[model samples]
Target chain A: MYDTNYHRASSVEEAVKLRSSQDEARYLSGGMTLIATMKQRLAAPSDLVDLRHVASMKGISVEGRKVRIGAGTTHAEVASSSALKSVCPAICHLAGMIGDPHVRHMGTIGGSVANNDPAADYPSAVLALNATVVTDRREIVADDYFQGMFDTALEEGELITAITFEAPEKAGYAKFPNPASRYALTGVFVAKGASGVRVAVTGAGSNGVFRATDIEIALSASWSSDFVASVAVDAGQLMEDMHATPEYRANLVKVMAKRAVAMAG
Target chain B: MAKVTLTVNGRTMSGECDDRTLLVHFIRDKLGLTGTHVGCDTTQCGACVVHMDGKSVKSCSILAVQAAGSSVTTIEGIASQGELHPVQAAFNQHHGLQCGFCTPGMVMTAVDMINRHGGQLDEVTVRHELEGNICRCTGYHNIVKAVLSANEEMHGASRQAAE
Candidate 1:
């Protein structure tokens, strides 16, 4: 890793100030991905504004059907949260399935969502649940929050404080994890709520995490695993990598969607 | 340069290192506690696992400055009074090591896993939880046996004492 200054920010305001003060500074939350990226020389910021100590940005709270997860809340915290599990067990289960125990101990919901890795697990939940991304400055709805792979609507120096969403009637996530890295080869998250059925696919989309409208429409009509299985995903729109061909990923999309629907039921 | 201070094992230590120095390097080089190994610096191979503030984390992936003020426990810290920790003893008895390259990380990870899951751990759970820590040797058969045995010994003994 390149030499850089590190500053521990205790509050969102201080974190933002620290970030803006440097020409190239990135918010360090969990540092699961950022640190690894830096070690590989993929990212070399002039300074790192560590947000791990930011008090207001670290927790999970659920009241009735409303759920709010602080950006700094670690995956392990989310996975083990009884309050969150009571209302939204699917999200909790998804959290438990990320990278591994050690990585989950340091990876945060905010960092995962902020990074918006196409293969990341959290974006599927965020998008499928239709959560709202609360930043220091504004609240962006999930639809508007995710722009593309490794891209989001977050402005530079803007920090995500929390994510809020209504507990869906039923929600489940299923992923075909890559054997080595455990990243989602093709993952699907399905949710049924007041807004109706929402299906989000991650790890396969060439354009990043995206809504599977055909499956969503089918599930809304029939609400069955068989319906999901019948919905054909276009291989042309998916990504082809060394691990899987786009056609195989397309098939996995349906298989995982079917499994997700079964799990949600 | 960053002056990083943290409590390693039970000892509060301070050191000066580059801001980019990994916690593993700081522990092994700066503090001269070389038990922690760095098998894969990219974070996949869990040869650098350590307990940070009571949770297992990849020390190689964390910067020394980021760990400042936090309490860390490394492989060197587990033994007491020259007596081997139960996990270490279990590994030794169960023949869990071959090259011994991944033992420190395996032991640290096993300690954390046993702490969290307790004596009720099954083979599947132990194997699943061992996902982060990779062992190319031993085929992980005896390592899994060692973790389970240690878990039972630690938590089961505590349960027996309570009863």
Candidate 2:
């Protein structure tokens, strides 16, 4: 690890200012990812702007059907929140299943969403929930937020403040996690909301998380496992890795979708 | 060097370290608390786990400066006065370790699991919760037993205190 300057930003405005002034600064949330990268000598920024203490960026709020979660909130906090459970238990369940208890305690949803790892759990949730990625600058809808694996639409100095979404009529998530790392092998999120039916697949996308539109259309007409089971997702569009082949991931997409719908029902 | 101040095991400790220094290194090299081990520095191994503001986290994955103003508890803090914490005592009684390399992290993680699960705990749940804390010695049979026993004893003591 190389020597760097550390700054604790008390406010979002101050955080932006700190980021702008530094020659090379990285925002620190929980340090679950960044610090590890630094220790591996993969990245060495000149400064670190700590955002863990900004009081305004922490909380879980559910008004009517809209759920707004602070960006700084930890996965463990989101997992255990009864307030969130009342409206969106799927999110709670999703957060609970991320990287075991220790990782959940240190990893933040904002960090996960920002990092946009192909195997991360939150991107599917955001895409499936039709959520808004609220940032210090402006709101980026889930559709426009994720650009690709390890990519997002967030501009330089843009900091995510919160994620807001409507509680779906029904939503369920299922993930086939890699045993060693606990990252998803192929995860599917299914939701039937007032807007329409949504199907977001993560951990199996060659281009990162993608919406399975065909699966959505089939489920929209009839919410049945038999129908979802019969749907053949294109294996070409899915990612192939050591844990799973493209055909295997394509199969997992279908299996996880059926399971998610069953759980949602 | 960056200035960081935080409470460690009830003592307000301050130190000057490189901004890249990990919290585990600060605890071990700077503060001279060698109990927290760093097995896999990439956060896969829970050997460096410690309570950051009352939540168990892999300390090696966290920078020392990130922990400024936060309270941290390590394995050395689990005992009260001269008496071992129930979890520690249970490990002794159950023969939960061999080389004892992963004991500190296992103990800290167990304390956290018991804290959250409360009285409603089972062996299966214990096994699931202990996934992050890997123990090569003893095959984890004794470690699992120790965690269950500790939960029982700790919960029993709390009940007696309440009564």
Candidate 3:
């Protein structure tokens, strides 16, 4: 069962103060994953600093070619935002397809990225988009942000404030969801950005979200579904689970990459 | 223990709860509102669905203190006086339940969805949106039907009020 002291923060400073002062404290956003983990006795913090009242930590805005999303913005908000739907439909689709409505309504993109479950969908998109995560302390690129499964570059008391992604010329995500948890068995996000073509895969990788450099190279040469499909993905490093084998997840990565590329077109 | 004050339905309720207490537990244990049932300790099940500040949220996934100063609408608060809420009435009328363990959550979820989605209920959409809420009984056919009927009734009432 969950156990913790509760504190609400009216601002980011208050939240940081609570985090710095409290023992074994964890910041609570939508509480979709955090609360569930607590209920299963997986995590037991001494205090929960609720961030709902942190006014600056909500919203989604598109300025020029980049879409900036506040850390505390819910998945529902992301999925339903008209601007995002128009400009970044793939991200919006990923948000809408995550788990179910209640989970989407309660889960925040920042929280999901921070938690970085190997099976999560958002990490792949963030990596594909090459997003920059702005925290209370500093901004970190996606490559620098995610270190390993359930790991990030965030410091002890830092709080993610927003994420900014350069709007891709075209992007799409395809995933084979685990039936039970609705998390991806293997998910791929393919995007053609100003930097170049990028292909990121989640759920299949043993170390969590990683770029499929082979597939990216193929797609960058010619942004086509056929090229993505022809790219060979080595499955030796994937994680094995009850839902699928390492080989199965690795195979799915290529298939999903092809589908995502086709959908992007 | 921490003191939390919030509006339930239209009435304000205040209580002190331990830091570990979930918002669902506070409603069921302290306020004696048992309409919100706990199907699973995990947040995977949407059995403890409630509305917080006009949005549907899983109460099991929130701390009581987190809900301070917010407006919460539990399943118990859906009924007024002795009359059943429209969604509840639709569930009953359409036999949307079997053992009834999942009805309260189903009804509340439907109400929230219909309110937000303009009451344009269809099978695929209802099934898609109701993924969080699980019903082992009735194959969810009657439950979906009930939600659709309630949507019409609710939207019709709104139209009449506008007239």
Number of the top DockQ candidate: 1
Error of 2 at B45 (Å): 1.1
Error in Å for residue A56 of model 3: 0.6
Candidate 2, A24: how far from true, in Å?
Answer: 2.0
User: In candidate 3, what are the lDDT values of residues B118-155, reduced to their tens digit?
Assistant: 85777889888888898887899999899888988999
Sort order, TM-score high to low: 1, 2, 3
DockQ of each candidate's interface versus the true one?
0.92, 0.82, 0.73
TM-score of chain A of 1: 0.99
lDDT of 1 by residue, A1-265 (tens): 8889999999999999999999899999999999999999999999999999999999998989999999999999999999998888999999999998999999999999999999999999999999999999999999998998899999989999999999999999999999999999999999999789999999999989999999999999999999877877889989988999999999999999999999988
Better of 2 and 3 by lDDT: 2
Single out the weakest 10-residue window by summed lDDT for candidate 3 chain B. Answer: B39-48
lDDT against the true structure, per candidate, is 0.95, 0.91, 0.88
Query: Lowest lDDT 10-mer window, candidate 1 chain A?
Result: A228-237
RMSD of each: 0.7, 1.1, 1.6
TM-score of chain A of 3: 0.98
Give candidate 3 regions above 4 Å deviation: B156-163
The structural similarity of chain B in model 3 to the true chain B, as TM-score, is: 0.93
For every model shown, what is its TM-score relative to the native structure?
0.99, 0.98, 0.96
Candidate 3 residue-wise lDDT, A124-217, digit = tens: 9999999999999899999899999999999897899889999999999999988888899999999998979888999999999999999999
Cα shift from native, residue A247, model 1 (Å): 0.6
Residue-level lDDT for B91 in candidate 3:
91
